[model samples]
Target: MGFLPNSMLIMARKPGLVEAFAGLGLAVQGPSALPDEIKRMAAFMASRAAGCVYCQTHTHHQAANAGISADKLEALWDYETSDLFSEAERSALRVAQSAAQVPNAVTGADMSALKQHFSDEQIVDLVAVISLFGFLNRWNDTFATALEEEPSAHAAAHMAAHGWDAGKHAR
Candidate 1:
């Protein structure tokens, strides 16, 4: 048997659910204090480490739109050995990987890198983005939510049509 009945699933797909997703989208997109590329990179690294295919796809396209190269994206699979990443990207990935594996595994080196590269405010937002996606990864994994479509496309269209900070949108 599946996790939930079809009727309940349908109810979960109602307008209120859509609104909640919209809120999350806005929250992720509303980090005006941080560069959009860095935020997307952080989210992508966290999602990759968490093994959330949905988020991986979403953040991959988001990275692409933010001017990340395909080679760099592919190198994310083995970021440690790849030359495609910058010091900042590598540092953030270290944080995400350590956070994913063991909470305190993010060491002094990681902290130093973060401090060197990102502002305090940006670090706060970065951590929040990581934490949020960690939660999302678990939730989506638990529910076995099939990532059938790329959310980045949806987000792009929404931003293009309405603007980046638009009030409401879909998942």
Candidate 2:
């Protein structure tokens, strides 16, 4: 977050991919009915389920920037039983987790649960957040994108407690 990420720096070799993602990133991350914090949470969960340490750290930084509490982030992977999350948050996170699976594990019951808490537009936005991270997770992990300082430090301080490490993405 402090400087250009290695992924973007490398992606620039093919400028068209960067241009395409610029618009898509804005569209997916831009303001909507969905709160930034929840979007960040979904992204963190998606990136984690995808095993992208680079994105996991980035989303951790963004989640903190968006005011997600350490308590919630600490309990993220265990949200199903975490008191820090409400049923609504749990539903969205469930979708993110399921959607991150290779075979796309989302079920009818998952959609129904999401519908109970989010409007149609919000659901789309939530899916978009998860979908966006799907792309980002693959990009960073595939490239072994080096961790940026701010996020790397943050992940070290806050995220390592949850068993995160830079691993192959280490700077």
Candidate 3:
């Protein structure tokens, strides 16, 4: 809602590419069975697993804005055992964590676990959230995109204790 993030700004230079990605972004983020909070949380964790400081800051900021509590966000790394999370949330976050790995660690058992909590369509949307961040993580990390003040501050406030920082993305 503020100024476009640096990734979008860079994408803006290629108008068609930006527009295309925006359209896809809208689709991935559009109305679905999954709530925005869950999707944003998956994105935050995906960005974290991908080790993209830029995306991590941005997604964590978004998750917070979507009403994800500070304590839950802090406990995301341990979602499997965190009392703050539901079984459905744990399954989805597990997918985010594994799917973001370099070799993609998502397993059939993981899918089975997710099926217990999510509909096929909902799973698609959930995976889309993770997939979108997969691309974003690579894009931002490759560019060493400058961390913006708002998201950087948000991450510092909420995620610094989790070993998160501006890192290579520092402006």
Candidate 4:
């Protein structure tokens, strides 16, 4: 990595915390049966729902790298009504949004809908992606981590039209 994120630098003050957090993050995001695009999309949506500008921009960049179309990414907040997403994608995004809510609003119907399209393992992966972003959302928001340049530029070019703002999180 050229420059470590501010969040990673802060976590580095406690090496064990950095190791454990990075390990879990790698494990959750590394090779898996779950398609990378879906995982990235879920992570992106979770970050959006959490209102973490740092994470939303980071995941949006990652999702673009993973080949998620700008159309799909832009339409994500309207996933339920958009034809850009498959039923499976919609289900997974719904799970991510619901689970990312402050009170953990995920419902049985959400799980049921997910089961209609994804295996238990895939469901676990979805939850893992959402849960990872939950940690990241809180970490970034609480630390007020400065937005890295690349993500900042990407957000301005691609996300500002969607109402994303750097706000207090801007470097």
Candidate 5:
């Protein structure tokens, strides 16, 4: 069901590339700096903006596993005044939103607001998260990858356990 010649299926043929993307994802969403939960939550929000249903479904599952509440998930789209998120989370979402909106409007005030809640290193990681989702959104949207679709249960299980580094993606 892809726009291109089965690009999703084709990506599976390159597990090394999948692994590489996962590494980047791990670096961005890993527990080393940014909280994996917050990273996944930001990804969910960006996926919504990108209209990538595949990313949304996968990230929704990931966010659930990370303990993101249903209330928070429901309010993610209008988080500016939502009481579900902490100040830190709101700031990160602001950054993610700016990045996801093509021709990003991330301003100095946005950066400053985010910086107040995160270290410089973590800010770098946050930007990486946004960038990754931007790439994922385009790929999923372009390929017309189906939501809830994956090559195999084994692949989904691996990715669920290992995060994006699990060597599987929609496109």
Candidate 6:
């Protein structure tokens, strides 16, 4: 049987809040100087760093749809030393990881490095991707949201080797 994720259903309990959250997420995912692949990758990295299974699975699925390779997704945790990522992708991933840390570990050096590779507007988009996933990661984790089937399967097939598990978010 099909099911709505608990996170969305719970948010739906407050229609206005759900609508507002969805609106803001759409805005963040809208067209930008930053490529969709980069935004998706950044979001995935943020979700992984946040340790939210539901968000991680969802972002991983989206990242694949945005043209990120299975190899890249599998190796994302090591992007800092991976040859698959470009300098710009590495910079963006670093920003995602730092920003997603608890207590907000992002530093000036992180932003400076990002600036070397991205325009100010692009940096904004990267931050927006991280911020969007940050909200989703907290919401899904708090709700123990059940993973949707597609993302669940995708994560199983592609993310398991990277230490991904459904955990409390299992469907």
Clashing pairs in 4: none
What stretches of model 4 exceed 4 Å from their correct place? Answer: 1-3
Candidate 2: tens digits of C-alpha lDDT, residues 1-171: 457878888889999999999899999999999878789999998988888899889988888877888888888979999999999999999999999989999999999999999999999999999999999999988999998888898889998877888999887
**Distance from true location, Cα of 62 in model 3, Å:** 0.9
**Model 1, span 1-171: residue lDDT tens:** 112322235336687975675587577668567777667777877876786655655666667767876667566767777887778777878887777654447888898998898888877877777887787667665565543334545434432332222122123
**Better structure of 1 and 6 per TM-score:** 6
lDDT per prediction? Answer: 0.65, 0.90, 0.89, 0.90, 0.69, 0.87
TM-score order, best first, reads: 3, 2, 4, 6, 5, 1
Better of 4 and 6 by TM-score: 4
Candidate closer to the true structure by TM-score (higher is better), 1 or 3: 3
Error of 1 at 53 (Å): 2.3
- Tell me each candidate's TM-score: 0.69, 0.96, 0.97, 0.96, 0.76, 0.94
Candidate 1 local accuracy as lDDT? 0.65
Question: Higher-lDDT candidate among 1 and 2?
Answer: 2
In terms of lDDT, model 2 sits at 0.90
Instruction: Give the deviation of candidate 2 from the true structure as CA RMSD.
Output: 1.0
The reply for model 3, stretches above 4 Å from the true place, is none
Q: lDDT tens string, model 4, 65-98?
A: 7788889888987899999999998889998998
**By summed lDDT, which 10 consecutive residues of candidate 2 come out lowest?**
1-10
- What is the alpha-carbon RMSD of candidate 3 to the true structure? 0.9
RMSD of 6: 2.1
User: Which stretch of 10 consecutive residues in model 1 shows the poorest summed lDDT?
Assistant: 162-171
lDDT of 3 at 162: 79
Per-residue lDDT tens digits for candidate 6, residues 54-122, read 988888887887777878887787899999999989989888988999989889999888999999999
Give the C-alpha miss distance for residue 72 in model 6, angstroms. Answer: 1.6
